[model samples]
Target: MKRRQTNTNFFDLTNLSGDIRGGAISFLVAVPLCLGIALASGAPLFAGIIAGLVGGLVVGLFSRSALSISGPEAGLIVVTLSAIETLGSFPAFLLATCIAGLMQIGLGFARAGMVSNFFPSSVIKGMLAGIGIILIIKQLPHLVGYDADAAEGLALFQPGGFNIIEQLRMSLGQFSGVAMLIALSSLAVFYLWGRLLFQQRAFVKNVPAALIVVLLGIFINELVRMVFPQLALRGNHLVQLPVPGSPQEFLQLFTMPDFSQWNNPLVYTSAVAIALVASLEALLSVEATDELDPLKRKTPANHELKAQGIGNIVSGLIGGIPLTSVIVRSSVSINAGARTRLAALVHGTLLLICVVTLPTLLNKIPWASLAAILLVTGYKLARIEVFKGVFAEGPAKFIPFAVTIIAILLTDLLTGIGIGMITGIVFILREHYQNTHRVRTEHANNITRIHVSLGDHVSFLSKAKLLKLLKNIPDNAVVEIDGTGSSYIDSDVIKAIENFGVAACQRNIQLVFLPARPAESPVYTLTELADNYRRNNSERGFRHDSQPHLHRQVNPTPI
Candidate 1:
């Protein structure tokens, strides 16, 4: 029989090739995204590129994930812009980036990676849906061939008292037929390229749909300029690359942080903001990316944190914007048939080469095509399937998801997530209380017997109801606690049961524990019981021989 391969060596070569192809495509996609996100953050254009390069080359190499893509993300636009404004300079923000990176490293060591797991699935889905709406709104102007200055104050629906509808209505006269054609054609090609022909056609699969769309957009723009100069859109709507004359010029573009101002309050505050936002974004991306992974491979979260920390450290050192695992690029990589980390590494290498050697070529790409790509991405993220699924999960989940989406649109990402998370927690607590606090009062042998079944997991939140039940127990009654049904019994619950057991003994009343076992004995003090009852149950097998019975001794005193 052929031995099954335990190691992942078979895909090693395949992964390399896949990485090169995916990386090339990712690099193409990243160019515009880097610049767009940087511009959005009110930072220098180079900052986004630096973050992409470091995220790919450094984070990719160090990350446990095989397919996650890292770069400057739109999610951090608010925080980055705010930090830049508060710090008063880009260099000061760099100091914060370094400090944030250090904090991330510390968080990893502290095993804080489990933070994302605590977030309800409904809230996370809502957060993504909210981001999708933001992307669609933000890219609307770009699709229509109008480039607005990158700033945070600009609302999605309103731009200086004019809503999106009004702006679109007013800008209709200024629309470039050529740009419109390019945008429409690029979208068309992107769609056709993903069809059966591209999958089965050998030569077609090799072509990057995004690149083709971009080139067509550029060609159309140039053709329009030559044939109808009056209808031509200005170069401001196109992607622009910095022309570095020499190696020295390229080196000089990198800005270093001033260590002398590290102690400034603004610097520390900016660092905290960066650390919090970057961590949240990265964790969220990891969750989404894992869901997208075809093999269902789980990326170690703590490892991811460390990798991001290293990437941010390197990115900041080279004057880059803070880096995180961006869902957009990671999704693109997955959709592009990327099989391993090689794809991410290749993408970074291609980006570096493109920036260094083909600056003019990159600058020729039209912004409309990039906007179209993002529009498609936004649509995918906020698709009807997501809404249908969340709705099917029930109102408890759907309400928070819907609330989070609306909150993000009205407020910001952080605030929106916070609101959704709070709503989700409340629902969870309510569910817990409802499930745990039920009392079944039945008559047994001329005495009242109350049977209370605890929930699977008990926390301090359920303590009050348990205490009330204990205090209200009628005298000369029998109480039976079926702890076997409970997966977890909290310390507070154990304390209440023990105190009640003593009270029952004093009243000459019977307190019986069903399926009684030494592990579930209330005779021991609450401090002696393990926090996790399931572990104790497993260690002490549930055999009939292990069951303990209360023996009545002659003239025994109630203790």
Candidate 2:
């Protein structure tokens, strides 16, 4: 059986060539995005490269996730920016990152990675939608050939009170015609391929649309420069990789963490925040990637956390940005037919080549093209159909989804998620309390019949509702408490029912149990039964039976 199970391992390396091809394809997707993300993060550009390298080479080696490509992610750009600003130096931020890595390792060993399970799916969808909207807003100016505003402040309002609408208005008069042409043409190609080949034809769909767009943008720019010299775009309009002249120059690029910053409280707080966001993003991405995998292999969340922790530790020490399992690159890897971790290894290796041997070639790629690609990515995340789907599920689902989206848009990712989580938890507790038991009042043969049907499990949290129901029962009525469906009852709840039953007779109401067993209130608490079960839970295996204070006529088991 173990051998049989081993044969199904997603990273079995049986399809090495395909994994290699997939990795190369995914590398094409990762390059421009890595540079763009690092630039947006205010980190030295090479930090993104180091992160991608460590994520692929180190995390891929340790993670069981077959096709999840780990690297510098878009979601953490805000956190990275804020931490660096707070710490006052990149070296101090690096110290915080290293501590974050250690925290992740501790979380994995502690099995706290299961925290993702507590999140509602609606809230998750909302968060992604919020991110998508932000992406589109930030990329729009870049798409139309304007880079006047800082990427972060480009959305709602600039420091000078110019909002996105005002920028769009200004762009109409001063935008780069050549850049706009490239972006429009790239979008046309992207849309054409998406409409014609995406998921429809196996081989054609595997050919990444983003790569084609990048190639097309470069070719168009080159052609324009040759013929229409007046229309040519230059400088920051294209990628700008720091080209090292020699091996020695490359070695000088690395920055080490300042361990002396350990005395700062803000350093520890930043570390905790990074560990939380990074771990959460990694876990969510792993779950989503598994669902996308054709083989449907589930990565152990805790194991993934440990791998990510080790990777971040290595990445931070080596002057890299914080890393996580990124969905964009992983989706490309999957769509390209990745069958193992080798795909990620290949992408990392290829990125290293781009950094070392091909800076000149990489620098020629247009930023407008990259912005166009990210714009489409954003659209996929924040489609109108997502809202429609959530609305169809009713308000119980849509409220959390909408709230999460709005919160994220108004604030940072962590704060938004915290707000959504608190709201979700509140709704969940409300529903649990509301449905803890069913009390139906009926009229039968001139008598008021109140049938109280208990749910499978009842805890102390149900006390108030249970007490209110007993108090509201009409005078001279038939009251029956049924516990047949319940497997376990909290001691406080059991006491409530017994005390209510005794008082029930005083109101000229006949109260009785529906063939239910009784127990000594103190002995039957979940605390006591839990200890009993931990000692031995099996039926006919318990060394003893619990003693109930009730008389033999009502010698009912706790159930």
Candidate 3:
């Protein structure tokens, strides 16, 4: 029998070693991801690296989740790009990043993390699927070696006039044969290695297929370039590292925001937009990471908010893009067998080393390989299995999921998520209304007895149902409303019930409230009646203290 250790603390040496191994794998994964996200975000390539490092080191140190990896995210590309444009410069955007971080910290302190619970599962899942599709479509051009001078960090598809199919068609005509071959080959090798060989080999099981694909792609690209000098792919298509002449030159790359922009209202407006979008993305990523954790550990959402705030602050200070709990890196960490937060810490250290010492080797890496990796990531995220599962859940779930997917494909991420969320909320409200005002009439001893059962939650949206149920009640009928089981009885439902009570009184109908308490005045509106009942119940230890054994009693009210 294994003895249980008293200490559940995070610093065990065994755990640390696992974290180190996981971190190394995460580092390898993050390098390409950081560069890709940065390139996608329209920021300098180095800025993405800085965000990844800070996310790993700072956020990793402060975060409560042992397995979460943080960095620049593709989801935040729109916000970052807009911030840069609105703020007029990268430095001005840095200021907004700092302010957004501060706002997140404040939200944490306010304990607003529980707000995520309000988001429906269907909507969140739909958003993830949408992002996955976006990732695949956006990276397609780079995979085919047609480097269009388009905005880097925008969504894969554009709304209104611009569309993904049109962009894809344009990109296909300008494809590079060499780059395409390298990308397709890298993808094939990755799939074969992960599928056929990984299951049989212990040593290679933990090795990232992405790293192997990258190495193979680089080698193939180099060989092709040597043999065909006339069809040379320019260095611009490859990853470029800023070659610093000296320590001073390297220091020059670190730029601070000009606070003079603070006076501009547009800057503040952009900051607000950045803060909202970044917060939403961070919350969503945190939720996704929690779900992906193998240990089933729940991350303290508020703590995560504070950690992200700290990461953004540090990232901004050093001229890095704003950071978040990125799904790609977090997923990589889990897939790599990270056991603790130390893995995240180690990943940051590896990033620092790569940027500082391996700039030349890093620059040699091809865009096609990274695109292949992202393509695989996209496939994993928007798997057909998810669609099948949604369909199995019934039309209610499928509608929101399909709507979100289409909305994202047609418009943008935020718009798509918004539509899905709205649809989900509407569904919930409809269900609530249906459940709350169910009226069943029983005919006994020449009198009609009506039983009304309110739902678990009764809000203003349920008023229509309540009114309709009350209007159909037989004249002089005995009515009994059961609110004892209700957890939430809203004011609207209360008002409607009160009006029904008055009508019942005029018709000589007797109205009885179930789980009745002594000294409770029956002459009150629905809202007042519920409030009065609640007060009486609290004093008498009714309804909430224990389940009362329900028994039907004879009543003398006439119908």
Each prediction's whole-model lDDT (CA): 0.74, 0.76, 0.72
lDDT of 2 by residue, 140-213 (tens): 77777775543332124323432668777766666888889999998997778767545587755556666778
Off by over 4 Å in 2: 1-26, 36-42, 78-89, 148-163, 166-170, 195-206, 259-270, 291-296, 332-340, 440-446, 514-559
Error of 3 at 89 (Å): 4.8
Q: Which run of 10 residues does model 3 get worst, by summed lDDT?
A: 1-10
List of clashing residue pairs for candidate 2: 517-556
lDDT of 1 at 118: 84
- Cand. 3 TM to true fold: 0.83
lDDT digits (tens) for residues 238-324 of candidate 3: 766666777887787677876777787776777677667777777877777666666666677888888888888889878899888
TM-score of each: 0.82, 0.81, 0.83
Which pairs of residues clash in candidate 3, taking residues 3 or more apart in a chain or in different chains?
40-152, 40-153, 494-526, 494-527, 498-526
Q: Please name the candidate that would achieve the greatest lDDT relative to the true structure.
A: 2
Q: Once model 3 is optimally superposed onto the true structure by TM-score, how far is the C-alpha of residue 360 displaced, in angstroms? A: 1.1
Ranking by TM-score: 3, 1, 2
Q: What does candidate 2 score in Cα RMSD to the true structure?
A: 7.0
Q: Residue 103 error for model 1, in Å?
A: 2.3
Writing each residue's lDDT as its tens digit, candidate 1 over 287-388 gives 877777776766778888998999888888889999999877887677667777878888888888889999988887777877777677677778899999
